[model samples]
Target chain A: MKHACKRVSQLTSDSFERELSLTEKMQLKLHFAMCSLCRNYHQRLATMAGIFEQMREHDLNQDIQLPIEDKQRIQSVLEKEK
Target chain B: MVDKQMNPKLWLKEHGDYLFRYALSRLHDTELASDMVQETLLAAWRGHERFKGDSTLRTWLVGIMKHKIIDHIRKEIRHRDISDRLEHDPTSTYFSENGSWQDSPSAWRDNPEALWDNQEFRQVLQECLSHLPEKQRNVFEMRELTGDDSETICNAYDITPTHLHVLMHRARLALQTCLHKHWFGGHTKS
Candidate 1:
C-alpha cells in the first residue's frame, strides 16, 4: 500500500507534464479509489499550481514598475543604435 | 515598409515595466528580468519588419520575452549539474524504506480560490517557494508557473521525460511539505 502510494504520487506529478499512458492512468484511478493519503497528496499539488496561477494574476493586477536606472541603461543602448 | 507604429523609445517608456514584470515573475531575478525586458525591446527594434500583425504589439513583445525567459533557463540548466539529481528521490527522506509518507499530507485550511485573496497565505506561499533548491525550483517554475511544455524542458535540460517528471515530482513534494508546515503550523518542525 505504501509503495503504491509512492507510485501514484509520482504518476500524479507526471500527469502535470504529460499525458499518462492508459496503464498508468488505470493505476492512479485504482490506487486513488482506496487511498485517501494519495488523494490528499494530489490535492496539495493541484493547490500549489493554483496558488502560482493566482500569484501571477495578482502580480499582473499590481502597478509594478521597472527601476529608473535600468530604464536609463536601456535607453542609452537604444541611443547607441541610432 | 518598416512599421513606423513600432517605436523603441515609446515601447521603453510604455511597455517596459509590464515586460519586466512578466520576466521577473518567471526568472525571479530583478537584474536578469530587467535585462530580458531590454533585450526584448532591442530584438523587437531590430526585427520590427518581421512582425506580421496577428497580435497586439504588447502581446508580440511578450511572445518574444517568453522565448527569452525559456532560453535563459535552458542556458542556466545546461551549465549546471542536472546529473546530480539523477533519479535520486529527494522525498525518500520524507518516506521510510516503506513508501508511506513520514509526514502524510493533510487538506490545506482554505480552498485554492479563497486562498488566492488571502494576502497572508500568499506571503507564506512565496516564502515556501523561495526555500526550494534552485534547480528543482527552476524546473517547477518552467513546467508549472511558466507553462512551458514538458518536451521543451526535457530537450533543453538533456533529460528524458521521466527525469523531468521526477524533477517536478520532487519539487511538488517539497513545496507541499513546506506549505503544510508553514501555513498549517501545528506540525511545523524547527
Candidate 2:
C-alpha cells in the first residue's frame, strides 16, 4: 500500500517543478518525511538540476557569433522601416 | 522607427542575440533566421502601439517572432515523419515499465536552484530542447530559457493560455525526465 502511494506521488513532476507555493512545499516536505521513496525521488531531482546547470555554463562560453554582415543587413532592414 | 514606448533599435540591440538564436534553432539556417529576426523587429516597430507594455519587452518581441515563425513554417515544405508519432506518445512505456522508485528516484534531487547554474547542464538542456517537437520546443525556449511570460508567450504562439501552460508543463516534465535518465544512467541516485 505504501509503495503504491509513492508511485503516484512521483508522477506529479509537473506540480513539483512548477513554482510551488509555500503551503505546497510544506505539504510536500511532510509527505517526503513519511515516504522514503519520495525522499529518494526528490534527491534525484536535485542531482538532475545540478547537472543541467553545469551544462548551461558550458554553453554560455561557446560564442554564438552574429557576423558583421548579418548585423549590418539586419540594421539596414530595420533602418528602412523607419 | 522607434516608438515612444520602446526604442526599436535599443530593443533589438538588447535582445537580438536571443531572438536570432531562437529563430536559428527553428529554421536551422543562419541567414534565414537572421532575416526572420529583422522581420520580427520591423513588425514590432509597426505594431508598437498595440504593445501596452503588459509583458516584458523580451516577451513582446518573442510574440512577434512567433508569428513570423508560423508564417515561415507555412510557406515551406515540412517533412513529416509518420514514425515520429510513435516516439511522442510514450504512453505504452509508462504503463509497461516496472513500478519501482528504487531504480529511478524523482529528478534533480539536489538543489532545484542549483540545477541550471552549470555549463554542461545547459548544453544538455539545449540538446534536449532541440529534440522536442517544434512547437513545444519554441514555447519552452521562450518561456523557460528566455524568461518570457506565459501570457505573452500564448499571444505569440496564437494559443490559449491553457494550451500554453499545458505545452510548457509537458516540455519541462519531458526535459526533467529525460535529463534524469541521461545523468543517472537509467538509475537515479541520491
Candidate 3:
C-alpha cells in the first residue's frame, strides 16, 4: 500500500523511455483512476519532456559561435601539425 | 590522397561552428567545447591517413568529437562537487516513509504547453537545468539534446538501463519542482 504511489510515479516516467509491460500499463491506469495527485505527477512529467523537446529545437538555432581566439588557436595548432 | 573535405582548414572553416555547438551542448562550457573541437580536428588530422572514407567527413569529425566529449565527461564526473553527488535524490521528502506523497504535485494554473513561447519560461527552464546535479545534468542533457537511443548512451556512460532511468527520472523530478516553483508560482521548499 505504501509503495503504490511512488512506484506508479516511477512507472509513469519509465513509460517515456521504454514500453511498459501490460501489467505496468494496467497498474498505472488503475492507480491513476484512484489518485489525482499521481495523475498530476504523470502529466507534469510529460509536460516537462515536451519542454525539453522545445528547448532542443531552440538550441539548434540559438547556439553561440566559436570564439575568434579559439579559431586562431586552432589554426596555430594545425600549422604546427604541418 | 587526402579527401578535400578532410583538409583541416576546411574542417575549421565549415564544420567549426557545428562542432563547437555539439560539444558545447554536451560540455556546457565555452572553453571546453572549443577545446574539444580543436582536439577533434587534431585527432582527425593525425588519423586521416587511416580513413577509409566509410563515412562523410562531418560524420567522421563528429565521431572523433564524441570520443573526446565522453572522455571529458569521465573526468568531469570525477571532479563533480561532492555535495552535488551526495544527494541528487530530488524525491527526498517528496514522499513519506510509507512511499505515499507527503505532499503530492499540485495543479499548475496555466498550461505549460501554452507557456512555451514565454521567454521567461524558457529562462526558468534553463535555470532549472543548471540546478541539477553535475552528472545528472550531463546525462539528462546528453539524452535530451542528442536524442540518441538509450543503449548508445548507456554503453558510453557505462551505466545500465535502470541506472539511466533513475538518473533521468530524478533529474526530471527536480526540474519539474523547480519550474513549478519559479514559473508556475507553486513554491517548492529547498
Candidate 4:
C-alpha cells in the first residue's frame, strides 16, 4: 500500500535469489510487519520458486535417449581431444 | 576434465554416448549438440590438470558441454531477431483476470496429472518446448532448467547481459502463463 511496502515486496524475490542488502532486509521486515499485500506477494514468489525447483528435479530424472550418430560424433571429438 | 593417464580414446569410448545424450536434451539439435559435446571433451582434455575431481567426471563433462551450448547460442544470435515480449495474448478461454490456474488458461493446464502419471509429461513438455522460439527455448532450458549463470547464458546467446535478463524474464512469464492454462487451468482437486 505504501511506497516502502512495494519496494519491500520486490526485495522478497531479489532476496530469494541472493543475499539482500542490510537496508533491503530491514526495509522488507518493516514493510512485512504492516503490509498484508506485500506478505502475500512474498509468499507467492516463494511458492513459485519452490514449484519451479520441483519441476527441474522432475526433468533431471526423466529417462531419455540419444541418437547413435550423435553418440559417435561425441566419441570422435573426445578421441581427437585425447 | 579427463585425467592425463585416461586415454582420450578410452575415455571417449566410455562416456561419449552419455555426454551426447545429456547435451542433446539441452540443445535439442543433433548435429550442433554433438559438436558441442565434442568440444566439451576436447576442452576437458586440454584442461585436465585443472580437474581436481571434486565431482564425478560425468559432472565435469556436463559443465563443459553447458558452456559449449552457450557459446553456440551466442554465435547463432547474430543470424536472428531477438525480442523480450511475452506471448500471453494468444487467444485462450482458460484464464482468470490475472491469468491464474483458473478460468481461461484451463484448456492447457487441465489434466496435468494424467500427463504426469503416464510419462506423457515428457511429450507435453517437448510440445511446449517446440512452441517456443528457438532462442527463447534455449535460454529457458539453459537458465531455468540447467542452472546456468546469466553471464554465461549471455555469452552463449550473443546478447548483452541486459537483453539476456529481459529474454529470460519474458520466457518465464510466458511459460508460467501458458502452463497455467494447460496444466492447471480448471481442475479442482477431487
Candidate 5:
C-alpha cells in the first residue's frame, strides 16, 4: 500500500506529461478510492495545472515592455549587421 | 515589392515588448532574452524579401524567436547535464519512508479560480516559478507555458523520458510547496 501511494503520486504527475496506460489508470483510481491523502494530492495537482493555464493566459495579457534603450541598441546593431 | 508594412523600425515599436516577454518567459534571463529578440529582428529584416503575406508579421517574428530559443537551449544543454544540478530527492521530505505522505495536502481555503483573478496571485506564481532550479524551470516553462510536446522537450534537453518525468515531477512538487507557503498562507519552511 505504501508503494502504491508513491506510485499514485508519480502517476498523478505523469498524467500531465504523457498518456497513462489502462493499468496505470486503474491503479491510480483504486489508490484514490482508498487513500484520502492521495485523493487530496491528486486534486491539488489538478488545481495546480489549472493555475498554470491561468498563468499562461495572464502572460498573454501581461504588460512586459522592452526598455527604450534596448530597442535603440538593437536597431543600431541591426544597422551595423546590414 | 517588399511589403511597406515590413519596416524594421515600425516593427520594433509595435512588437518589441511582446517578443521580449515571449523570450523572457522562456529563457528567464534579461540579457539573453534581449539578445534573442535582437537576433530575431535582425534575421527577420534580412529575410524580409522572402516573407510571404500568409502569416501575420507578429507570427513570423515569433516563429523566428522560437527557433532562436530552441537553438540557444540546444547549445546550452550540450555543455552539461542539467539533471546533475538537481537537488537530490526533493519529494522525499514530504513522503515518509513507507511511501505515504508525511504531510497530506491540506484543502486550500481560497478558490483557485478566484486566486487567478487576483493579480497578486499571478505575481506570486511567477515568483514561485522563478525560484525553481534552472533545468527544472526550463523544463516546466517549455512544457507548460510554451506548450511544447514531451518528445520535443526530451529531445531538445537531451534527457530520456524517465529523466524528463522526474525533473517535471520535482519541479511541480517544488512549485506547489512554494505556492502553498507563500500564496496560500501555509507555514514557511526554513
Candidate 6:
C-alpha cells in the first residue's frame, strides 16, 4: 500500500509526458477505485493541466500590446543598425 | 493592392506589437523580449534580399524571433545550475512518507471551461505563474505552453529526463497549491 500510493502520485505526473504501460494502467485504475483521496488528487491534476492549456491559448490572444515607447525604441534601434 | 515588398520600417509598424507580445509571452521579461524583437528586425533587414514572398513578412519576422528566443533561453540555462535549487524546495511536504498526499487536493469550485471565461480567475492564475521560481517557471512554460518535447527541453537546459520530470512534477504541484488557494477559497479536504 505504501509503494502503491507513491506510484500513483508518479503515475499521475507521468500521464502528462507519455503513455502508461498496461501494468501501470491497471495499477492506477485499481488504486483509484478504492482510494478516494488518490482519485481526487488525480482529478485535480487533470483539471490543472486543462486550465494551463486554456491559459496558454487565452494569453496568446490577450491584449498585452507592447508599449508605444518600446515600439519606437526598437524601430530606431533597427534603423541605426541598418 | 498592398505592396508586396514593404519596407523594414513599415514591417515594424505593422507587426511589431504582435511580435513583441509573442516574445514577451515566452521570455517573460520586457527588456529581453524587446531585444529579441529588435534582433529579429535587424536579422530581417539584413536578409531582406532572401525574402521570397512565400510567407507574409510578419510570419518571416516571427520565425526569426522564435530562433532568437530559443537561443536566448539556451544561453540563460547554460549560465546557471538549477538542479540543487530545484531539489531543495519544500514541495516534499505535499506528500507523506507513504507516498499519499498529505493534504489531498479538493475539486476546484469552478470547472476549467468556466474558469477560462472568468477574467479575474485568469488574472490570479497569471500572478501565480509569475510567482514560481525562475527555473521551474521556464520548464513549465516550455513544456506546457510552448509545447516543447521533453528531449528538446532537457537538451536545452542540459538536464536529464529524470530531472526534467522532477522539475515538472514540482511545478505542477506548486501551481495546483496556488490555484487552490486563490481560486477555490483555500484548500478544502477531499
Among these predicted structures, which one has the highest lDDT? 5
lDDT by residue for model 5 over B39-119, one digit each (tens)?
999999999887897888999999888888877888888776555444477778778889888767776656667778888
| TM match of model 1 to true structure | 0.85
Task: State the TM-score for model 6.
Answer: 0.80
Error (Å) of candidate 4 at residue B172 is 4.7
In Å, residue A10's CA in model 4 sits off its true spot by 4.6
User: Per-residue CA lDDT of candidate 5, range A12-55, in tens?
Assistant: 89988888999998988888888888887777778888877776
Prediction 1 global C-alpha lDDT: 0.78
Model 6 C-alpha lDDT per residue in residues B1-190, reported as the tens digit of each score = 2345557788778887888888887777888787777788888888888877888778888878877877777787667655546547566688778666787766564678887777787788888888888888888888887676787677667788878877777777888888888878653424
Give the lowest summed-lDDT range of ten residues in model 2 chain A: A1-10
- Poorly placed runs, candidate 6 (over 4 Å): A77-82, B1-3, B49-56, B80-91, B145-152, B185-190
- Residue pairs clashing in model 5 are none
lDDT (C-alpha) at residue B9 in model 4? 59
> Can you write out model 1's per-residue Cα lDDT over B124-144, one digit (the tens) per residue?
877887888777777777766
What is candidate 6's CAPRI-style docking category based on DockQ? medium
Measured against the true two-chain complex, the DockQ scores of the candidates, in the order shown, are: 0.64, 0.30, 0.64, 0.21, 0.61, 0.59
Which has the better TM-score: candidate 2, or candidate 6? 6
Find the candidate with the highest TM-score and give its number: 3
Model 4 CA lDDT for position B176: 49
* Candidate 1 ranges beyond 4 A from true positions: B78-84, B155-158, B185-190
Question: For residues A5-81, could you state the per-residue lDDT of candidate 3 as single tens digits?
Answer: 87777788889889999999999999999999999888888777776677666665455789989999999999899
Please tell me how candidate 2 rates in CAPRI terms.
Answer: acceptable
What local lDDT does model 5 show for residue B66?
A: 83
Candidates' chain A TM-scores? 0.79, 0.55, 0.83, 0.74, 0.86, 0.75
Better lDDT candidate (4, 5): 5
TM-scores across all candidates? 0.85, 0.57, 0.86, 0.64, 0.82, 0.80
- The parts of candidate 4 lying over 4 Å away from their true place are A1-10, A60-62, A73-82, B1-5, B42-56, B85-137, B158-185
